[model samples]
Target: MAIEWKGIFPAFTTKFTAADELDLPLFGKNLQAQIAAGIDGVILGGSLGEASVITTAEKETLTKYAVEQVAGKIPVVMNIAEGATAEAIRQAKLAAAWGAKGLMLLPPMRYKSDERETAEYFKAVAASTELPIMIYNNPVDYKVEVTLAIFDQLQAYSNIQAVKESTRDVSNVTRMISRFGDRFSLLCGVDTLAMEEMILGANGWVGGLVCAFPAETVAIYKLTKAGRIAEALAIYRWFLPLLELDLHPKLVQYIKLAEQQAGLGSELVRAPRLALVGEERTRILKVIDSAIATRPVLPDYLSL
Candidate 1:
């Protein structure tokens, strides 16, 4: 179950009930859709999955459930976004024990670690687990940035296999390729930048909106890889409005709302993140509804 680090890997949203409990049935349904749509892997407890609010036990539950659900049809990757290095390592070990095939590790959360500290944290975690890791290098959302120099230091860890490149500059894909070559697999982390990055040689996509629109997201990635640019661009153009929702602060609520609209999941976010309402709700629904209304007929992307 090693990670190939190529193709669509959704940063799946954790479904919650009205009482703020894990809605496994709904979560499983969406996961089934993602697998059915031909994703390369599934990441649990990511930013989109409300990782901060989810407790360790809950994350383990999610990892175990997803592992069982996918049943080795695909890799189940657990996201380790802990603030403490020891905690991150502990989670990595637990994820391995729970059957997670890979990890998506962010720089130490909350505290903005210096480059040296960041490299140490990553190295420490990498040494602790044999699991293949995808570094979440999202400087825009998270204050810390994993620059190429830091990656130069990290290249020693053979398990540090890929990067979730979210710098938003599509050119960074080429930059990573120029610097690292195939030393590290590069996956586009931003939904809006997926097509651009993919065209520039990104190995995969760690998508947020794919939680709601798995088939369309996978379509764009598959078509682009097949050298079907015109067909991919047509779908990407139609999908632009819905994809923009992932760049917002309240992405969890926004994406969960889209899931609800698509009959995929509920919009119940954890405390501190209330579900979208009033003008905001109306505005977002307009985007989601409009996209659904004009949803394009997909081609046989898998056959490509």
Candidate 2:
């Protein structure tokens, strides 16, 4: 019930060049701005950062660059999800080499795997690195779910220090905390469920929309932590439409567009990932606009 971690840890968006290379300079600037805005840390290349489409080498390169830029000002957690134990291990080692402070690992998924396979995968990856690791449980999109027993089996892993529970089930978040208590930190993954998880006693949040609105996300976490329920709800309800976008398949596209509109990052995602356009674009804007109208005032970067 007592933990020092507070405020937002924005799942940072990646900046891309016109040709779609990672724009690390812009990324560094964004990270610095978030820290200045009182964010807790930066989550590099999570769902918001579109880690799935990027290459293995690209993940390593981006992870390396982010660590250097942040320069230990705050924590930097690298996403290390892949299809196999070998690849995850390789990436974890590289992230350690790259100076990452923590590792975020989603369940191993390329196909359906049984309990043994899932447990072993996490065990292997956990064995590979000493950096504090957070289990990224995003079953809806990844098509894999780790049961509570899996967490029970892995409690022996000291480095497996946190969890980004994206199951979108507040009960599961509460259940895990009830079972494990402070054994593992609970990180709310779905932005729509942030306040609920925080209210129920989650450790922190690993957010996607923070790519577009780090200050607002940080404010949400801070208010929740301070027990200012009405104030936090005011902000959360205002941003409900944007958080709803988290459920869509083209979330990264919309998130990047939000960043572009805010002048924080570019919308140029890698190939096989197209930008939101036409009717889709119009609908998303309407959602964002309605949320902005509900809010008292838009944050400076999100204005115009």
TM-score of each: 0.99, 0.92
- Counting clashing residue pairs in each candidate, in order, gives 0, 0
Error of 2 at 116 (Å): 1.5
Candidate 1: which pairs clash?
Answer: none
Local distance difference test, per candidate? 0.93, 0.78
Clashes of 2: 0
What is the TM-score (0 to 1) of candidate 1?
A: 0.99
In model 1, what lDDT does residue 52 have? 87
- Estimate the overall C-alpha local distance difference test score of candidate 2: 0.78
lDDT string for model 2 (24-83, tens) is: 788877787787767766777676777777776777787877777767677778887788
The CA lDDT at 206 in model 1 is 94
Best by TM-score: 1
